[model samples]
Target: MITDPVNRFIEALHCFPALPRVFNPWFSVDPEHDASSLAPTHRIDNLSRYLTERLGRAKVILIAEAPGYQGCHFSGIPMTSERILLGQLTHKGIYPGDVLSGEVTRCSRTDGPVGRRGAKEPTATVVWQAIKTAGLDPRECVLWNAFAFHPFDTDMLTNRKPSSDELRDGLPMLHQLLELFPDAQRVAIGKVSKGILDKLDIPTSAELRHPANGGITAFRTGFAEYVGRL
Candidate 1:
C-alpha cells in the first residue's frame, strides 16, 4: 500500500493509457528517451515534492482545464515551466532548492524532430504572474489541472481542447486528488475545468477566467477578488 499521496497520485496517473507520458524529476533519465538528451525528470520530481509540501499548508486549490504542450508537458508540474524548474523566476514562497536538487538539462524528444528547448510557456507565465499580482502565497494554494495530460492536435505542437471522453477517463484521478485535500476549497480556472467539476457534482468556491487568449485581465481581477475574500 502506498502511503504517500504524491506517490499514489503519480501511480494512478500512470495507469491511464490515454494520459500522455507523465514526467517526474526523481529519475536521472527520461524513460521515453534513448540516451541522447538529459531528462528533466529530476526537475519534475523536485517540483512535485514542492507541490506536496505546499499542499500540506494549502487552504485552496486552483484547477485549470489541462496541461499545455509548452507547459506541464515538459516540466511535469502544472502551471510551471522550465524557467520555474531552473529557478529563473523569483517568486515569493517558491525557491529553487526546494524544487530542484542539482543540475539537470532539459529533456528533448529523441524520436521526433527536436522542438524548442527551454521556452517559457505563455500560459504558465500568466498564471504565475496572476498569482503574484494577487498577493497570494504559493504555500496557501495548490495548482492542478482537470486533465493532467497535454492534449495536442495532429501537429503535435498545437494544443486542443480535451475531448469529453478524455475528461471522463481523467475523472478518477481528479477524484483521488480531491480526496487528498478534502478540506481545501476548490477554484476552477476556466469553464472547461468548472464544467468537469459540475459533472462530478463538486461545488467550487470560486471560478476565474483562464489567463489565455486575451483573458489575462479578467483572470487577474477574478483571482485577486477571490483571494481577497479568503
Candidate 2:
C-alpha cells in the first residue's frame, strides 16, 4: 500500500530513484515569466496541505489522467503552475501582496522534477483556464490527479499514462481523499482514468473527454446540463 503520509513519502523517496540522465525541459521554469513557478523539491506535503486547507470541502473533484510535466509532477502542486496560480489568485481576488498571507504555505527549493535539473508544475494559466472553463470555484470543486506522484517514460519528459498497476496502487489514496469530501463528485478525464473511478468504487458520470483532444468542446456544451443535474 502506498498509504504513507504524503510527507513521509517525500522523505523516503530516494534522491532521484529514477532520476533522469540529463536535464529535461519539463522541469525548468522561467521564473521571470513563470513567477514563483519552480519544480517540486520533494514538496508533496506542500501540495497536500494546499489541497486540504483550500479545497477539502469542495463539491466536485477533478481527476486528471496523470500529472503534467511542469505542474503536478514537477512543482508538487496538484495543478498549480505559476501561470495557473497567478490566474487562480486573480480569479479568487488575491494579489501579489497576498501570497504571504496565512492561506498558502511557502515552498523552498525545486524538486528534481526531471532528473536533478528540477521542474515546475503546470502554469496557473493552464490549470486556472481548465477550472474556469469547467465553471468551478473553490467552493464548487477540488482538484487532483490519479497518481499522486509524477511518472515519466523517457528523458524526453513525455507524460506517461498511468498503467493498470499504477492506478490500482493509487486506489487507497483516492479512497482516502474521497472519504474526506462527502459532497464531492468525480470528474475523470481520459479513458484510462475513467475506468479507475468505478474500480475504486467512486461513483461518477461517464468518462470525460481527454483535455488534449476535443473533450474541451463537449465539456463546455454539456457543462450546463451536468450542473443542472447537480
Clash-forming residue pairs, model 1: 25-41, 25-42, 25-44, 25-45
**CA lDDT scores, all candidates in order:** 0.68, 0.50
User: Please, what are the lDDT tens digits per residue for candidate 2 over residues 14-103?
Assistant: 222333322222334324222245433324444555555544457777677656656654345565553233334465443322211134
RMSD of each: 4.2, 7.0
The clash count for each model shown is 4, 18
C-alpha lDDT of residue 78 in model 1: 77
Q: What TM-scores do the predictions have?
A: 0.80, 0.63
Clashes of 1: 4
